[model samples]
Each structure stands twice: as C-alpha cells, then as structure tokens.
Target: MTGSTGHTDTRKTALVVGASRTLGLALAAEYLRRGWDVIGTVRGSGRTGLHDLAEASGGRLTVESLEMTDPDQISALGDRLARRTLDLLFVNAAITRGDLPIGEVPTDMFTEVMITNALSPMRVVESLRPLVAPAGTIGIMSSDQGSIALNTDGGQDLYRASKSALNQLMRSYAARYADDSRTLLLMDPGWVRTELGGPDAELSVDESIPGVVETIERHQGKPGLHFVDHQGQVVPW
Candidate 1:
C-alpha cells in the first residue's frame, strides 16, 4: 500500500478479540476499511457476521476461533499468532446480567461476569502483548459504568462492578509496564444499539465505531495509559 505522499504505507494489522457480532464485528470491519489487516475472533466454530466480513475483505481479514473465558484457548491463540506482529490489540468481550443489586447477585453469576469481563481480557493482553509492535496500541472495551465518579445513578450494579474491575486491572497492567513504548487505552464506545446495548441504546454502531477507531489512532504514539470515550474525551477514573 502507498500513501498520498507517495510513501509506501505499511499496512497495519489489528487483532480484535470477541469479534463475532455487534460492536466487535463493526470494529473489525472499520479497521479493515481503514486499510488494516484484521484478525477477528469468534467463539466456537459457528459462522458469524465476521465470516461474511472475511469473505468480502479481499484477504485483508482472517477469522479466528477463541473462547475468551478459557485459558487454554487464549494460550493457543497466542501461540498461533506468535509469528505475526500486531499494530493494535483490542479486547472487546463483555456480558451483563440484568440490573440486580450487588448483594442479590448470585455467586455463580458474579463469578461468570467477573471472569468474562475482567479477568479474561487481561489474560488475553498478557498472553499476546509480546506480539504487539513496539509502538502499537493495546485497548480494552470499557464502559462509562465503570467510572466510579460517574456512578451516581446507581443501577446495573453487577455489570458496573465487572467493568470497574476491568478498569482497575488495566490500571495495574499499565503500572507494571510503565516503561513500555506502546500506548494503552480503555475505550468507552458509549451506548450503541447492539445485543448487549439493547434496543434503547442512544447510538448506532455506525455512529460510534469510526470515532472509536479515530480516538485510538489519535493516541497511538503517546505512551502510558488513557481512559477515553469514542469522541477522544477522557473519562474519569
């Protein structure tokens, strides 16, 4: 690929985890549209919208299988992609269990949410961080619900807690890798209309993802960590 400046453009590669449908699928598609080679993952072997995207991507997109909650699967993916360098690694898996009060949330449900939304993403980052280019970006799909300062409405307690935990863990990950050249981001894509966002969401995927991609691109070479929304505004911790 070549840029308008007549320089050879090194086409970047992005790994979008949990990219079967909804926001994840949109993200993968947007990256591909922006001239990025994308490796998008879906859980299980089932064909998904991502597969359809791959078919039309002119070999720029590859679909991979990943059950994010399984450590073995994560490790296997890491091994499989070990030879490739990624310009972006974004983990986009999350699940919500209704609006139950924190105390009323079942132990099993709590465990599942925490494992899926919090622990698993960090595990993926750790396992795959080495494959990221020296100046690459590492981003996690975080929500404004995770912001303690913005939690005054006090609803969706369980979901809120999981995202909060995700933010905290990403914070620690940044602290530990303080000297790394790669930029780290926790992105809030806003309430887009998707399966998780439900029918009442205020924004469409088309309205949100392009800006999210731009925000990540804007912060590329700035080291350290940032918690920002799709509009490039920083979200409170």
Candidate 2:
C-alpha cells in the first residue's frame, strides 16, 4: 500500500480483540485505513460488520473468532497466530449490568462483569504477548470512569469498580514486566456512542477511535504503561 507520502507503506499488523461491532470494529477499520493489516475477532460463526470490512479490504483484513471469557479460546487463538508478528494487540471488551450499586449487585452479575471487563482481557494479554514485536504496543480499552481520583459524582458503581480493577491489574502487569520494551496503554476512549456507551453518549465512534489509534501509534516505541485518553492526554490514576 502506498501512502500519501508517495512511498510504499510497510504494513503493520494489528490484532483487535472483540471487534464484531462498536468501538472494536471502528478501531479495526481505522487501522486498515491507515495501511495496516488488521485481524479482527468476533464471537461466533455468524457474520458481522467486521466480516463486511474484511470482504472489502482486498485481503488486508482477516476475521477471527474469539470468546474472550473462555481461556481455551484465547489459547487456541494464540496458537493460530503464533507465526505472525503483531505491531499492536488491543483487547476491547466491557459489560455493564444496569446502574445497580456495588453492594446490590448479585454475585453472579458481579462475577460476569469482572471476568469480561477485567480478568479475561489480562488473560488474553498474557497468552498472546509473545506474538507482539519487541517494539510493539499492548493496549486495553479502559474508561475515565476507572479513575478514582476523578470520581466526584458517584454513579454506575459496578461499572466503575470493574474498570478500576482493570486499571489496577494492568498496573500490576506493567510492574511484573517492568523491563519489557513493549509499550503498554490503558486507553480511555471517552463516552462514545455505542451499545455500551448508550445512545446519549457525548461522542460518536467516529469522533473517538481515530484519535485513539493515533495515540497508540504515537506511543509505539515508548516503553512502560500509560493511562491516557483518546486525544493522548494523560488520564489520572
């Protein structure tokens, strides 16, 4: 692919997890538009918007299947992509069970949200970190809601707690791999209008994802973990 610079684009590969629709799908498309080879994962055999993007990508986009909650699926995906080197591995998965206070949340509901939003993403990162290039990036779709220091108006307690847990776990992961050269990012895409963000969200996917991708690209060679928003502004810890 030749870019606007009139030079042949050295294609970088990106694996966008949970990319069937919404923000994940948009991220995949943005990367593809920027001359990157994109592998986007959906949940099942059924067709999705990502499949549509792949069909029109002239072979630049490959669609994979993944159930993020299942460790077996994650391991299987890691094995399947073992030969390919990835420039970016981004895991984007989140769920919210209404606006229930944390205390009122059922044990099962709490477990499901935690696993989908926090544990499963970390599991995927751990399983697939080997496939990423040494100077590549590993990012998770986090939210500003996760910032404890900025939680002035308290609502959506369960969702807040889950994102906070995700951030904390990423911190631990960064600490454990402190010497690793790869860049780690916790990206806050803001309140984009998606199923998860609801119809009343302030920003659309178009408004959020390009900046998110650019932020990731700008931080490519910078080692260590950063918690930042779509515009590359540092989000509070």
Candidate 3:
C-alpha cells in the first residue's frame, strides 16, 4: 500500500462498511481468513449475524456501529477510527425493492434507494478516505445492472439507476484524485444468493466472494478506478 499520512500499523486491516450481514459479513469473514484484522459496522444496537461471526473470529474481528444514511454517524465513525490506518475500506451499500419500473416506483421509495445505494456510500468513502493508507484500496459493492451500455433488456429499473449513479459518482471521485496512487474499485460480486440478491440469484455467496477478494488483491496499489466483476473482469460503463 502507498500511504504516507496514515498510521504506521504493521497488521493488515480492513474497514468493512455495512458489515452486519449477508455479503458484508461474508466479506469480513473472508478478509479475516486471508489474515487481515477486520472492523465491521452494524447499523444500531442489536445483535446481528456479524456479532456471531465476530465471536468466532478469534479476536480478528471488531464490530462497530454506523448508519450510513446519517451524517452524524458517518462523522462519528470517522472520528472513532481517525488515527487508524486502513489497508482496505470497502463500502457495501444495500437495498432494492422489486421489479417495478422506475416510473411506477414511489418517490419516497426511490429516494431511499438512491440515498442508500449511491449517496451514503460516497459519504462514507469521503469521510474515511483520509484514514486509508496511500498504498491501500477503496472499494464499493456495485452490480452489473449499473452498466448503462449493457441496458438492452431494460430490467431492474430503479435498481439499475441507483447503481449507475453510484458508478458515475465513484468515477467523479476517482477523477478528482486521479494522481493518487491508491486503488479505487467498483466491484460487482455478481447476482449472489443473499437476502438482497434473493433466492433466485444465479450464484451463491460461497461461489462468488473468493473471486471478489482475488479481484481486489489484483487491483491493490494500482492508481485509478476499475469497474470490475468478481472475477476481475471489467464491466461496460
């Protein structure tokens, strides 16, 4: 990693945002398995799947609190880990309603989806960017539906719009920091079977995350952003 301003910690460390369950939990667990110390965030004051995972992590994992939608919480999270140097900061955004067309979706529902999927994650990234080592990696959990050029079939409606917005936001963020040596990744983990991905998804978590982790490793220390899939293949913008 290329950091000059981050803390001088020797252990490999990762800050996995929204890590209370599903893909986030799995990713945190995988990072631990790969020999990194993990700090995972759950939204509020309740026991979650991540708590159990943390218990079994043999002290390799620490659970923190964050509600990505809130600026106060984001500020608090930044302060809480300010001195810490993060080897990897992966912002795992969430939520999708149904197959309704964008025109049919309610305004409130659309707002929630866009904020949760696009805006909040970027807020998290901006707040935590200072803590990431210059040699570190920053990632956002994206989906292939975000590909605007690949929209021939026109399914997933608002979900596609949110991810596309996320991709564009990250692209702008990357452009602003183009000279920085840190790696920026928009990683699509495929349609894995999760609460978010639904039961009908083509891939299982066990089948996908290992490749996702590998793709992140491949991008480490590389400057600029890559919109890539779990297998390190680039997706069309």
User: What's the lDDT for candidate 3?
Assistant: 0.92
Would you estimate the TM-scores of all the predictions? 0.96, 0.95, 0.95
* Steric collisions counted per model: 0, 0, 5
RMSD of each: 3.3, 3.6, 3.1
**Full-model lDDT for every candidate:** 0.95, 0.95, 0.92
Candidate 2, residue 157: how far the Cα is off, in Å: 0.8
- Residues 44-127, candidate 1, lDDT per residue (tens digit)? 998999999999999999999999999999999999998788999999999998989889999999999999999999999999
> What tens digits encode model 3's per-residue C-alpha lDDT throughout 1-237?
325887554669999998988789889989999989899999889999999988998987999999899999999999999878898999996899988987899999999999999999999999899999899999999999999998899978999999999999999999999898899999999989998788999999988989999999999988899999998999999
The count of residue-pair clashes in candidate 3 stands at 5
Q: Once superposed on the true structure, which residue ranges of model 2 sit more than 4 Å away at CA?
A: 1-9
Against the hidden true structure, what lDDT does model 1 obtain? Answer: 0.95
lDDT of 2: 0.95
Question: Given candidate 2, what's the lDDT at residue 135?
Answer: 94
Candidate 2 lDDT by residue in tens digits, 35-69: 89999999989999999999999999999999999
Q: Looking at candidate 1, what is the lDDT of residue 118?
A: 99
